[model samples]
Target: MRKTTYLLPALVVAIVVVLSSIFVVDEREKALVLQFGQIKAVKEEPGLAFKIPLIQEVVRYDDRILSLDTQTIEVTPSDDRRLVVDAFARYRIADVVQFRQAVGVGGIRVAEDRLSGILNAQIREVLGADQVTSDRILSKDRGELMIRIRDSARVQARSLGLDVVDVRLKQTNLPQRNLEATFDRMKAEREREAADEIARGNEAAQRVRALADRTVVETLSVADRDANVIRGEADAERNRIFADAYGADPEFFAFYRSLQAYETSLKGDNSTMVMTPDSQFFEYFKNELSTNGSVTLPDPVARAEAPDAPAPDAPEAPEMPEPFNLTPVDPAPVDPAPESPEAVDPTPEAVDPAPAPEAPEADTPPADN
Candidate 1:
């Protein structure tokens, strides 16, 4: 009974010791065996690992890729333009032992902090180069700049047992103090371009308008000249026709002109005219009587020199000849009379014994059609 009690207790103590010495490492993690704060073994593979109980302890670290977000930082480029930048990084523990030694009890937390500082420093150095500008930082070429930051940060991260896989700028922006000013400048530039375009457009339009006006003036001038030429030709043709008609029959032309005049003057029922009966305008009417009989003409100069009113009640002049008949009549043969002395001289022999002048004849009315 005594042996059983002693063996059972010893077995229990050994089992406890064995169980405490065994440690497990997952596929996603790496294990570190440390003896009094000094690394003794590294378990990089997933499996059961042994350690001295109460003397050696195992620390597990994630072997997967990690992410780190850096704080926003302000950097000034070579042109003295200030910018705010945010960045992020992808990294992994390349040397777990070195990581443990470097971070000590703080582990991944402390390592990340140190890595962030290194990344920030590298970012500032590369971006603040003499040839670097804010435009380059914000452009597609920014990818190259990020590569440079990663390469640079990778070198510095080695000391903390970190491998920087990639570095990227998350945001690049103008500082708040300069944002409004930058926007104002851009707006002004656009407005100036717009004004220039408008001015050019107006100038082109004015040129087109002027060209159109000049063309219109030229066209009108040509049209007017053609119209004047046509009118001149027409007038010449009309004059030629008039000349031909006049040359063919001057008397008939005169008659036609008189008829046209009569038509024009008597176009309306209310037409009125005042003229002496012996005026040339009535030559046709007077000549109608001459067609049947010869007309007698008096010498104006002799009549004016000799004609004077006879004394009243002097010897009655011989009975005056009767007036000619107005209607047409057949000719009748008659005896020839002796020539009168007054017929040649167109004056009486004695003006003082001349008879009173016969009453004037009444005016004849125009013939009806």
Candidate 2:
């Protein structure tokens, strides 16, 4: 019974050691066997793995893709514009043995820290290159920039047994102090462009207005010149007609002109003229002239040039004559005297003061026909 008890204790201890040496690795994990801080073996596949119990231990790391958000950092681009940038990276541990050797006991946390530093440094180098600018970082080309950063970071991360699958820029913006200044600069640029456009428009408008004004002046001048030419032609034709009529009949023309003057001078409700009673203006008013129809009017031009005759000497001063009235006055008609029985027919032959000496009595008696 004492021998059975010792064997049973030994078997239980052996079972405990075997169970501790055998470990099952999960599909999502990578296992590293370490002997006193030195990497002895790596388990990259999911299944049972063996290790010397009490002398070695297995360290497992996630084999799935992992994500890390880098800290916001400030970088200056080629144009000297500073920017605040935020980024994220997707990665996985590709070499568990290398990872265990590099990170030691710190494991994924330490590896992540180192990867973050690598990503940040690569971002600065690529984004701050001579050809890169702040505009490129915030534009569609940012994808290209991120790819460059990932490639550069992947090279550096390989030393840490990490594979950088992709890197992306999440946020890229101007610093707080620069935001207002940038906006102001943009506003000023736009305003300058607008002012330039307005000036150009005004210049074009002025050009159009000037052209229109010149055209208007030219048109009006041409029209006025034509109008004046036509008016002068009309006046010349009128004078020609007047001259022809005057050449046809001087007496009739004079009478018609006098009638026109009278009509002009004696118009309206009240018309007055002061002149002598025997003035030539009333020459047609004489009964003898009116009955004879043989009116003669003095030529004004001849009268104006002729010297005045000497006044007749008067024994006494003549009395002042009353002013002539222009108003028409009808005279009383005189009745003809009745003919007497012995009245003489006053022919020119009977009116001779002295008888013409009978034309020496004809020698022969006149024959009657």
Candidate 3:
């Protein structure tokens, strides 16, 4: 009975000790054997691991890839342009022994904090290079720039036993104040360009208008010159026609001119003229009277010169003969002379005159004369 009790308690104690010494390491995790706060063994592969009971303990960590999201940080580029950058990293605990030594009990949390700082530093360094600009950071080359950032971060992360797989810029943006200022600058530039375009258009329009005006003036000048030439030719032709008509008949032309003068002189019914009867204007009337055998009146000058001539009652004067036409006519006998001149009355009523002759027979001789 005593042997059974001792052997049973010994077996129970052995089982407890064995159970405490063994620990499980999953495929997704790595295990660290710690002896009184000191690292004794590292179990990287999956399955069961052993440790000294009551004197040692096992610490497990994730072996799979991890992600870390960094806080938004402000960085300035080579051009002195400030930007807000947000980034993320893909990493893993590459050296678990080194990770335990460096991080101690803080585990993945401490590792993440240190790696995040490293990534932020490298981001600022690569993005702030002299050749890098804000435009390039936001351009298609961003991927290549991120690769550089990752490589730089990896170099610094080696001390922390972290394997930096990749680093990527998640978001990039300008500050709110800078964005507003840029918008204002762009708007002003566009307005200036628009004004310049309008001015150029007006200048071209004015040039075209001036050219059109010049063309119109030139065309009008040419037309007026041609019209004047045509008018001069017409006037010359009219004068030539008048000259030819006058050369054809000089007498007819004179007669026509006289008639035109008469028309001009006697234009109205109230017109009056005071001219002598013996004037050349009566030449046509005298010729008609002579042709019809009518006696012509003596000129006023001849009557005035014959004041001492014989009177009509005196018989001493020879009888006058009739004027000839185609042949001569005989003279009539004269009475005995009364030498002294007969007493004559100077007044118009004293003499008994012969009967007035008709207009057609005024030139014929009287039988009693």
Candidate 4:
């Protein structure tokens, strides 16, 4: 019973000592000592520490870097590119006293709030510069732009005793109005290009088809002309052969042609001919009739009695005109003796030559006047 009593008091003292002087610092935390609500010292190492039982107290704070996920915000670039930026930052508390003095018990909240405002300002300042335009900022450059924003925010956020390791975005997007306008314009442009290309193809196809048709027409026309030329040459050769045969015997040709004409024009029932019974041409048909047993002829001597062979086809005589009755007139008597040129006067008139003064006759001699 005495040993049990001694063990109980020792256990009570050990529990008091364990509870009063022991301090633990985790890997992610720092232990701070406070005297009468005033910070006396800080233990940054991760291990157990000692503190006065009733005079000093230990407080723990997070020493490792922590993350603060800020709210998403809409931002406009310099060249009218709109996007939503969800930003987050990594920071650590470097000055615990200042953090507590500024935010009381909820000091991390104050730092996060202040960091959000400052990070937003830095993002706006960097992205709103002249270089960050719609054309310059692309999906490939998003990571690089984030790095620059984080670096710039680091310098500005370091003054608050909290290191800003990084600032990141969760998402980025265009505004509704800008997205709709871009989609509509792209659709219209593609449709117009397709229409123009199709029209050009159609025009080319038509031109090619028309050219082929023209070529076909020209080829057929040339072939037709050549065919006609060949036909004319064949006809000329046939005519030449016939002329050679016919020039050998013109009379036989005429006789054969007459027979052909008779067969064509006179063999029908409606044919007629004006011919005598004993005519020369009648012999052809007369002999033909006898060959067909349609007619018989007596001896040539008895047949000579029939008009004596039609008088051997009498020769035709030309008609003579009546003679006119006209009497011939005698020329006038001419003087035998020659007259001298002085006997004639200038005019061509008949003048009688006067005999030399002759003896008187029954009539008195003409006076020489």
Q: Per-residue lDDT for 15-108 in model 3, tens only?
A: 9999999989999988889888888899999998899999999998888999999989989999998999999999998988888889888999
Q: Count the backbone clashes (under 3 Å) in each candidate.
A: 0, 0, 0, 0
Q: What's the residue-level lDDT of 230 in candidate 3?
A: 97
Off by over 4 Å in 3: 187-369
Candidate 1: give the clashing pairs.
none
TM-score of each: 0.63, 0.54, 0.52, 0.53
lDDT of each: 0.77, 0.77, 0.74, 0.67
Candidate 4: residue 173 Cα off by (Å): 2.2
lDDT of 4 by residue, 140-242 (tens): 7777788888888887776776778777877676777788887898899999999999999999999999999999999999999999999788767766654
Please state the error at residue 234 of candidate 3 in Å.
Answer: 27
**Lowest lDDT 10-mer window, candidate 4?**
345-354
For residue 142, model 3's alpha carbon misses the true position, in angstroms, by: 1.1
Better of 2 and 3 by lDDT: 2
Candidate 3 overall Cα lDDT vs. reference?
Answer: 0.74
Error of 2 at 195 (Å): 1.8
Estimate, for each residue in 116-204, the C-alpha lDDT of model 1 and write its tens digit: 99999999999999899998888798999999999999998998888999998999999999999999999999999999999999999
Candidate 1 has its poorest 10 consecutive residues by lDDT at 342-351
Better of 1 and 4 by lDDT: 1
Off by over 4 Å in 2: 1-29, 33-41, 46-59, 129-145, 229-369
